[model samples]
Each structure stands twice: as C-alpha cells, then as structure tokens.
Target: MGAGIVGLATAWQLQRDGFDVTVIDAHRPGQGASFGNGAQLSYAYVQPLADPSIWAQLPKLLLSRESPFSLRLRLDPAQWAWGLRFLAACRAEVSARSTGTLLALAEESREVLQQLLADTQAHCDFTTSGKLVMYGSEASFAAARHQLDLQRALGGAEQHALSLADCLRVEPALAGSAARYVGGIHTPGECAADCARLCDALHGALQARGVRFVLGAPLGALRREGDRLVAVQAGNDWIEADGFVAALGTGVTAFARRLGVSLPVYPLKGYSLTLDAPVGSGLAPNVSVTDAQRKLVFARLGQRLRVAGLAELAGHDTRIETRRVEQLRRAAREVFPLACAGTETRPWAGLRPATPTGVPIVGRVGGAPANVLFNAGHGALGFTLAAGSARRLSRQLQGVAERPRTAAALIRSAARPAENSA
Candidate 1:
C-alpha cells in the first residue's frame, strides 16, 4: 500500500473498475519520491540506465570519491545480489529489450496521463515543453544518437539531433554553457510537471470520487490467510480488501521480506534542489534540460526550476548530505549562473526502488498470493511510468489479457504473491 504517484494511480484505476479503493501510507501524499522529483515526464527518452558503456565508467565510479555516482559495498546480501544482476544487465541486447519494453509502457503512460489531466481540472504546472539532453563528449553524443535510433526503431516520438548552436538556439538559456557540448538530442512531446502537485491533485480527486485513505499510520504487517492476503496491519488497524498491491517504493523491499519473499529491488538515493526561476528571466530554462555528463536534469516548473541528479546506493539512508548538496549546487551554478541572487534553494533526497535492468515489476511473482500484486521497482522513471503500470496491473486483476506479449513479459513477472505467511 502506498500513496505516491504509482499507488494513487493504481487506486484511481481500480476505483474506475468499481472496487472500493483505499490508499495506505505512512505519511501524507507526495512526501516521498512523488515530491521534488526531476519533474520530467520523459515519454520518448526511455533508454534503460543499465547500459554497456557503464562498464567503462566503472573505474571512475569506483575510485573517485568526488564522483556523482557513489557505490558503497554493504554487508547486505541483497546489495551484492542486485549489483551482480545489474552488471549482467549491462549487455547491449538486454538494453535493447528493455528499451522496447520501457518505450511501450511510456507511450501508454503518456496517453493515460493526458486522459487523466483532461478528466480533472487540476493544475500541476504540466507542460509539453519538450526535452533537450546535452552531451559534452563525442562518445556520449554518439551513445545518445544510438539511443535515439533505438527509440525510433521502437516507434518512439520524433526526436532531433541538435548541434551546440542548435541547442543554444532552441533554448537560449544554455548559451552561456553551450561551449562544452558537442551536440544534443531534442525529443518533442516530452513533458515537465510538478509530480508533487499531481499526487496532491490525485488525492483530492480520489477523495471527491469516494476513495478512502489511511494516512499517518505506518504499515506494520500483512495478515495473510494462506495463499491470500486477507488484511494489512496499519498501526492498530487491520484493513482488508479483495486484493492488495505492494507499491511501497523503497519500503516495498522490507514489506516483501515480511511476506517471506525477496525482491531484487534496492534503493537508489537521488537528490534535488528547487530554485527560483521567475518568468521572463533568461537565467532559467523553460524546456527540460538534461546534462548527460553530470547526470543532472533541470526542468522549469511554474516559476521554479527543479535541478536533480546523483545515484547513491548506500542502504536505506535518506540523510541529505550538506556537502553533496553543495557539490550539486556548484555544478548547476557553474552551468547556469545567476550571480547567486534572488534565487531560493530547496534540497530533497528520495529513495527510488529500482530493479537490476531498470525495468519495473508490474504483475506478481509466481506462487505469491493469488490476490496480491506488485507495482513497485520503478526507480527514477516512477513518475513517467506510473499510469501505464497502474493500468496494466488493473487489467491483470480483472483477468483482461494484455496484448503485445513481448513488452508485457518484461513489465509483468510470472507470479503473484508467494508463501503468504504471517
């Protein structure tokens, strides 16, 4: 049970099917990854992060203390197991399959999100401002071009390769920093929206539509009745439903463990900073900008700019490091300097549950409970893929067969909940 974008999306879809829906969460809506995310609904740029090129970057990743991507080898067996699987997924073929799977899901998500927006008059600063990803090195640019080709082959959106000058022309805010990049890729139909706002809007809509919420109560346990989850223990209440979904994000791993099951999911911690990006100010970018080298993404949300990056794998820690925040601020400031005046900085860190292949698990694992499903392991693309996954899971619960068997194979695992003990 969760109240983030994914959980809320699932609840909304289930409510549409006439199930009495209830969202369970430890806190209020949008306080998790749904809050202060990169804010880019990357519809077309669905390339899997477990790429082959990461092999070459492993040296810098392992040795450099100042590196943005940090890896701390913990004593936990799950970390090592997940790490090895992640390495195995770094092959070209695996990446291709995953790209296909993600693109299909992303396309569906785009449609679902559009339909959701149309149905509700909720304002979350959603914009089709497009996305521009800048690559500084020729190698990186070539990789980006290859990724663009892959997406095109999978019938993705119309994306254009832009030279440095073209990048500056398209978004003049990058003019000051365009000297470093060789070229970039601009994907049309891409979007940027406040994820926290969407979560809030969904919460309000669900309430108005008669959905229930059990907030401020941390999930305590799952009381299963042999091959079926009859109820969930939240604080002092045991709420039962016809079916249950584990969409707890990072907490899904722990909750799954309580069910005597192990998930390949691990938390990849990422940070963000929100800045004052006033309208008509040339200092901020209206279109979403992704620095391929730094891994930081800048998206303009209303009058604020969301700057987010870094993937730190170090257990379940959610502490915001002042130095790391300073480092991110320094890098972002260097690229987009505003003389450090009249700008506010709001820092945030979140634990995004990610699988090895950067692919999410939508359906259930075989031998789990018959009525239990999983909608977690979305990693960083949680916002981008929430609606699609929710819709897919909804179809599964209703016994509606899914088409395009290939993509569905990757999105949904073979089983449901397993060994429903305790």
Candidate 2:
C-alpha cells in the first residue's frame, strides 16, 4: 500500500494486464520517496550492499561523525537485530550471490522500462545519455574494475572503463573536474529521467485506464479469513479486492509481519538537494554521475540539478540534518563549483527500503487470503529497476506463466524471524 514508484509501477503493469487495480497510500501520489530521488536510471551499478569488507568498514564509519553512512543506536532491539542481519549478509559468498541476482533483475527491469516508455508514449525528460561513476582515489578506481568485470560478465555490453580524460570527453560538462577523477566507468545505454514527472505521467495514465487511487488513507490492517487476505482496512473503510499486492517500501515489513509473514526490509534514509541550473555555466552534465568515494550521485533533471546520497540507518524519521545537507552541497561544489546557482535549494529525505542481501522481494505469497504479491525492498535501485520488477510481479499475479525457479527465488526469499528481537 504505497504510491511510490514501485507500487505505482506494479499497478500500471497489472492494469495493462487487464487486472482491476487500485493503489492505496497514506500520502498523496508521488509525495514520498518517488517524488524526491536522484533520478538516475543506473544500469551499470548492480552491486549488493553486503560486501565482504563492509563489516570492518562499518565500525569505522559508525565512529566517524562526518562519515556518509551513520546508524542511530537506539534502545530498540529490532534495530540491533536488523544490524546483525546486515552484518551477516556481508560475507563474500553472500554478497557475490546477491550481486548476481540483482544484476539479472536489473537487466530484466531495464527492458521493461524501455518497453513501457515506448508504449505509453510518456514524456518525462527521459534521456539515454548514459551514466558515469567517477572516482577520486586510484584505489577506489581499481576496486571498481572488479565491479565493471561483473557487469560485463552479466551481458552489460555498453559498460566501459573510461580514463579521466575520456570521461570528460564523454560528458563535456565534466571537463574542468577531470583532474579530480582518476578514472570512471561509463554505461552508455543507461538512462535518466525526472522521477517526479514520470510519476505524474504514470498516475495520469493509470487514471485514464480506470485504475483507482486512494490517497491520504493510512492502511490499518488486513482483514483476513484464515489464510486469506479478504480486504485491506484503512481508517474507517475496508477496500475489498480479488487480489492484493503490497509495495509499501519500508512499511512493508510491519504490514507483512502483521500478516504472519516476514519481509527483511528496513529503512535506510537518504538525502537529496535540488538547485537551479546555473545560467550560462555550461556545467550541466549530460550523463548521471556517481562519486564512488563520497557516495554521492549527481543528475541533471530538466532545469534543475540534483545531488543525493548519504545513507543513515535512522528509522522512519525524515528530519533533515543540516550537516548532511552541507556534505551534499560541498560535494557538488567540488565536482562542479560553477554549477551552484546560489538559488534557494530544496532539500528532501526519503527512506529506501533496503534489504541486507540487496535483492528486492517481488513474488506472490502462497497460502494467502488471495493472490497476494509483493514488489518491494528495492532500495537504491527502485527507479532503475522499477519497470522490470513490476512487469515480472504483474505476470505472476495474473498467473500467465511461471518464471524460472532461479528468478523466482531471487524475488521471494523465505520468510525468517527477526534475528534481533524487538
């Protein structure tokens, strides 16, 4: 029950499949994370968060107050349990397997996005100019080669390792910043879109297709009959449906728990700042960019430039930390100082529903009240992989044909109890 990109995309795909779909959300459409993302359709980056070295890095990261990553140490036992699971998933073998699975889903989702954009004729400032991951440190650039190899191994033909000069050549706007970059990976076929605009277009399209939207309605609970979810109770009303699909991002975990299912999704809060593109600065990038070391992403969205990154494991709070915003501003200035227009900046925060293994949960929950499906837990790749994930979930919900077991397994992990008790 979300109106974010994942939920809306799932609903759109189902509607196209002739399913009577209704999207319910506690907030208005496109007013959540989907409204305020970095807007990069990053296909070259399919890496999982659970790196083998992440555990070692975490202690240091947590200790460093200015670090891009931070974890709030509350008294809640659930946070501790989630943290332990996150650490456990950081093993080399687990990370490798998760990376492989994510790459497959991301590639599939990319194709679906292409088809959807074409068929819907949706205009949302979409461009396939490509994406670049720039590195300041030689070591960071060297480490990225392994990731590039993985992408190539997974049929990412357009992915290439570019020299610093070559990166600037590909995106002339980065000419001045060439000295700061040692090298970068360029994914030529990757895309970028104004996410908010895309969501608006999709919302209109869904409305035209007779899909209903129940906005500003907080879901209370699932009205269940034995093993079946009969309807969703929201506030003072019950909306009954033949089937149910849950794509509620971070909120999915609680809802699923109430339904006696466990979803390993947790909130990873990220921040973004939007600024007007500097007039006559010639600093607007044609391709989206990721500063690997700083964990910041820069994307040019229409007349505005978006700088977003920094993951904080603070649960469900949208409070904007001034320090975090300053970090984003400083990073953007370092990359393209002239691009800063000195205009009033709009700051935003969103909770990315991150799973320890980095793969999203996208499948039907059997032995349910009805045809219950899930298409959530897509953390940072939500915008990049929404189309593909939604298409696959829609197919399963409609019972058209079964996907391969490997694909199904990647989408639907067996439910496990919270390792750290709340």
Candidate 3:
C-alpha cells in the first residue's frame, strides 16, 4: 500500500521470486522517509536505541531540549501506549534479544544487497568505504563494548573495538579531531551510497521489468470480503491485488486502524543536513563516521557529505526547527571543521516509523485480512534492513517458511568511486 524503500525493495524481490509486482505511493519514489537518510549501509551495527543504558539518560531524554534525543508528551493515546511498551523493553534481556534479531537480519540483508546490486546493477554513488563509530566519553565507549561482546558471541559481525590511536590509524581523516575521541568501533565492511538515488535506480529498474506503478495518489479505502482483502482505492482507481504488504512507514498506523489492526508504529522525527564535500579533499571524511555521543553520522556520497542525527518524538511533524538544524550544523562543524561548508546546506526532516522494541513487524497480522502483511516500524534502520525484511516477506508470499528465531540461529552457522558503474 506504500512505496518507500521497503515497498520498492519488496517489489524487486517479489518480481525476482516469479511474481508480478505493482508499487503504489502518494509521492515520488525515494521522496518519503527514504529520502535524505544517513547514507551509510551499516550492516554490522544494527543495535536498537532502546537499551538498558537509556535509563541512565532518561532525565536528559525527557527534560533537555538541547540534548540530541527529545520526547514530547502528547495527548495521543498511541504515544502513551508506545511509551509504556518502550519502558518495558528497556530491560537488559530484551535489549540483547532484539540486538541478536537485528544482527541476524543485517547479515541476511548484506548477502541479499550484494545479490541485488550484482543482478540489477543499480547505481547511487555507491562506495565500499568502511565505517567508524567514535565515542567521546569513557562511559559511552564502555557501553559500546557490551554491544561488541554481543556481536562477538553471535558471530558474523567483524567489528573491533579500537583505541584512539588505532581509530586514527584506520580513518586518518579524523586526525582533525584526534583529541575529541576516546575510542571507536571499526567495521571495514560497512559501506555508504546515495539512498535516494538507489530508490530512483530501483524504480527505473522495476519499471523496465514490467512492474506497474500508481504514483501521485494516496491509498484510499480497502475493500474487504469476509476475512480477506480484495482491492484498495487509490484516488479514483480501484486496484486489486492477490496479496498486499503495508510498507507505509508511519502512515501504516492509521491505515492499519481502518482494518482493525493495531500496529505499534510511532514516528521518531529526525533531522539531516547535506553539504558540499568533494572526495580526495582533506577537508571531508573519506569513510563513514558516527559520533556516539552527539548521535550524528557523517557519510560522504560522491561530492556531498550527509550529516544526520537527533531524535524528536513529536508525532508526524516534519517541520525543520532552526534550532535543531543549527545544532546539527554546530556539531558537524565542530567535528569535521572544514569539511562541511556553512552555506549551501540542504536541511531535511522525516518521521522514522518505529516500534518500541526496535524490531520491525514483518509478517502477517493475526485476525486481519489473511493476505495483508506488514513491513513497517523499522525506525532508524529502514535503510539498513529494507532488503532483507522485504525478502522475508517475499518468502511468505511464496510459501517459503523461514526458521524461527533465525537471528540467533544464523550466528551459530556463520563501493568506491568506481561503484558509479553499478
């Protein structure tokens, strides 16, 4: 019913699995939440934000507007309900389980993304440049080690904790702020690309494969007969599909409510800024870098640097607050200094559809239409997990059964500038 990355990727996977596909969206492809996302394809680091450590930062999260994370209490019941469930998921055990699940999905995604790129040959300024996550404080660095320990135990995650010297050795571009960082986690396999460009490439690729697209109209009412869904109204057109997947991002919550399904999806609004950063210039980072404390991520795609971070739970509002944008500017300038130009900045804000547990809901809904499946609530990882999650949903449409708890089980078994030709 939606056509964000999840929808487009789902169509791509389904067509590969020997099924006809149709993608419908109210906006142009990649113009939704997929647009302006942190460009890094961070497959190794899929940790959820709902950690046991959040308890220690609750005061800052709730009370300090200047903090990177902020939550506004609302009159909406959904917000209250989602908040309570999030609190329950803040325990140590739940966080670990979710991490295992996400890591497994990330591995599956890594494999599938390689295959997708190899087959479709889509180009989005892809780069194989590795990712470095730097921590400023001792406590933050220590807390990251716990996640590395979890990944080490689960397997397949080739991440190593690094001292400041080692971090600089791996990503010498950070020499500008050598004294600012205490430690880091280096994953050389992590990559980045222009996500919006990927969507455009996928949209064109799918169209060439005979897939139909109904764009520029909102999905209207769903026609249900008994326990099955037959068709849906998009503008004035009546489109019927044998099966339906709701990849609506934040729009799924309202869409699901019409069908008596209560999806635990809420919007976590985030901000991003893009600036001029040419490669080979000593000013910009050659690899992806994430500031653990400020929650900012910097990814250089072609000649542009994508700086994205900050979490504001203020419903579906997409307004770009000048203060928040300035904060991002300050952070980027402080970290990269000369890399990000003060002017020529492109500011963007999108609502990241998220569940309390950080695990995406990717299967059929109980008691709802038998053919209606969900692929929403991915939060910050919609980019990282889109390919694999869509693949799982495709398997369901093909009657291929996946192993239960595959994240935990899979562990036991286990781009450069030239990428433009992709």
Candidate 4:
C-alpha cells in the first residue's frame, strides 16, 4: 500500500493485465522516497551490498567520519538480526550468487523500461545518456575491470573498460577532474530519468485508464477473513480488491508483521540534492557519473542535476543531518566547481528499504493471507528494478509457473517465523 514508484508501477502493470487495481497512500503519488532519488536507471549495476571486501573496510568505515555508509548501534532485535544476516551474506559465494541473480533481473528491467517509455509516451525527463563509473585508485580500477570480466562471463551486453584518456574523450566535462581519476567503465545502454516525474506521469496515465488512487489515505488495519485478505481500512474507508500487493517500501516490514509474516527488510537511509545546471557551463555532465570511491552518483535531468548517495541506518527516522548535506555539497564543489554556482539547492532524505542480501523480496508470501504478494525491499535500485519486479509479480498474480529463486525464498522465509527473528 503505497503510491511511490514501486506501487504505481505495480498497479500500472496489474491494470494492464486486466485487473482492477487500487492504490492507497498517506501522501500524494511520488511525494515520498520516489520524489528525490539518484535518477539513474543503471541497468548494469549488479554489485550486491554485502560484498566480501566490505568486511575488510568495516572497522575503518565505522570509525571514519568521512565514510558514506554509517551504522547506529541499537538494542533493537530487528537491527541485530539484520546485521547478523548482512555479515553472513558477506561470504564470497553468497555475494557472487546474489550479484548474478540481480544482474539478470537488471537486464530484464532495462528492456521492460524501454518498452514502457515508448508505448506509454510518458514525459518524465527521461534521457538515454549513458553511465560512467569512475575509479580513483589503481586497486579500485582493477576491481572494476574484474567486475567487467564477471559481466562478460554472464553473457550480456559488453561494457567498455575505458582508459583515463578514453574516459575523458567520452565525457570531456570530467576534464576538470582529469588528475583525480585512474580509469573508468562506460555502459552506453544505461540511462537516467527523473523518478518523481515518471511517477507523476504514471499516476496520470493510470488515472486515465480508470485505475483508482486513494491519496492521503493512511492505512489503519488489514481486514482478513479465513486465510484471505478481504480489504484494507484506510481512515475509515474500506477498499476491497481481489488481491493485494504490498509495495510499501520502508513500511512493508511492519505491515507484514501485522499479518503474521516476518519480513527481513530494513531502511538504508540516503540523501540527495538537486541543483540547476547552467547552460554553456563546462560543469554539466552529459552522461551519468558515478564516483565509485566516494559512493556518490550524479545524473543530468533536463536542466537540473541530481546528486545522491550516503547510507545511514537510523531506524526509520527522517531527520536530515546538516553535516551529511555539507559533505555532499563539498564533494560536488570539488568534482565540478562550476556546477555549484546555483544558489538554489533542494536537499532530500529517503529511507531505501533494503534486505540483508541486497536482493529484493518479490513474490507471494507463504504466511500472509491468500492472494497477498510483495514488490518491495529494492534498496537503492528501486527505480532500476521496478519494471521487472512488477512484471514478475503481475505474472505470478496471473498464475505463472516460473518464479525467481529470491521470490521463492521470500515465501519460504515467511512460512518460518523463527528463522530471522533473532
């Protein structure tokens, strides 16, 4: 029950599949986390969050004030449980397997997104600008090349491994940081789009198709009748549907718990800043740029630029930290001094719903009432994976036989309440 990108996309797909779908959200569509995202449709981003290398950097990361990822020590049982699972996922085999699965889904998503944009003609400030992942050190560049090897082994589109000179040739705007980068990787198939604009466009298109949207309707309770979810109570109004899909993002875990399902989703809070890109300034990057070392991403959307990164686990808190905001600002200025000339800056914070293994849980729940499904826990790649995840869930709802392993695992996990309750 959400109106963000995931929910909207799922509803759109379901409606197209001849289902009467209704969306309920506390706020207007695209007014939540979807409002200010990295705006990158990084189809080739297959790295899992719990990489084997993260273990080596964990200690320094926890101590360093400049680190992009942060953790808050808490006594909460959920936090401890999630942290242990995350550690277990740091194994080489586990991380590699998850990356392979995610890569497949990412490839499917790219195809689905292209068709959606072309068929629907949604104006979302969508751009076909490619993605450039810039590495700073010899070690990092080597790791990226190794990743390119993995991608090639997976047998998909070939991503070019660019030398520093080649990287500059592709996106000359990076001439400003010519001395800072060792090398870069370029994926021309990747793209960037304004996520909020897409959500708004989808909302409008869904409305035109007669799909119902219940905005400003805060969920109160779920109505269940003998192994089936009958309806949803949204502020004294009862909205009934034949089936229900939980795309609630950060709110999914708690909502699932009300139905006796234990979901291992937690929030990885992130921040973003939008600024105006002055025309004729050498500061604007034509293609999306990722600072691999600092874990920041910059994408051009129309006349504005979106910079997003930093992961903080603060337990569903939406408080904006000025220090983190300044850190992003400082990094932006260092990377593109002329880009920060604009006085107006729109800063935003969103809790990206993440799973321990970094793979999303998208399938029917075993413990939930019948006809209830999920399309959440996408973490930072929500926009990237939305279309494919929704398509899978829609196919399942239509009684499709084939299902992904992660989706099956989610259902199995839901059946065993004692599994992840630590």
Q: Give candidate 4's TM-score.
A: 0.94
Rank by TM-score, highest first: 4, 1, 3, 2
lDDT of 1 by residue, 1-422 (tens): 99999999899888887788989999998899889789999989988779899999899977776677988789989888878888888889888877877888888899988888887677999999899999989999998999999889879999999989888888888877777789999986799999999899999999999998999999886788888889998889999988899899999878777776677789999999888785565678888999988888999888888889899889899999987798778877777776234476768999989988887878676546767788888889999999888888888788763322222243333222111100
Q: Listing every candidate in turn, what is its Cα RMSD in Å to the true structure after a full C-alpha superposition?
A: 4.1, 4.3, 5.7, 3.7
Kindly report which residue stretches of model 3 are placed more than 4 angstroms away from their true locations once superposed: 278-281, 401-422
Full-model lDDT, candidate 1? 0.83
lDDT of all predictions, in order shown? Answer: 0.83, 0.77, 0.82, 0.82
Question: TM per model?
Answer: 0.94, 0.92, 0.93, 0.94
Per-residue lDDT for 171-251 in model 2, tens only?
A: 777876778889999888887888878888888888998998888789986777766778997767789987788889889
Question: Which one is best on lDDT?
Answer: 1
Better of 2 and 3 by TM-score: 3
Question: Per-residue lDDT tens digits of candidate 3, residues 1-422?
Answer: 67788888888999999998888899999898899899888889977888888899898867876699887788999888878777877888777777777777878888888888888898888898899999998999998998898878977468899999998888777888888999999999998988889899999999999999999989888899988899999889988989998899999889888888777789999999999884464678888999987889999888888999899888888999999999998888888887865355669999899888788877676646878888888899998888988888888788764322222221121100110100
Q: Could you tally the backbone clashes for each prediction?
A: 8, 4, 3, 0
> After best superposition, candidate 4 residue 13: deviation in angstroms?
0.6
Clashing residue pairs in candidate 1 are 364-415, 365-415, 365-416, 366-415, 367-418, 368-417, 368-418, 369-417
Of models 1 and 4, which has the larger TM-score?
4
Residue 257 CA error for candidate 4 (Å)?
Answer: 0.3
Displacement of residue 365 (Cα, Å) in model 3 is 1.4
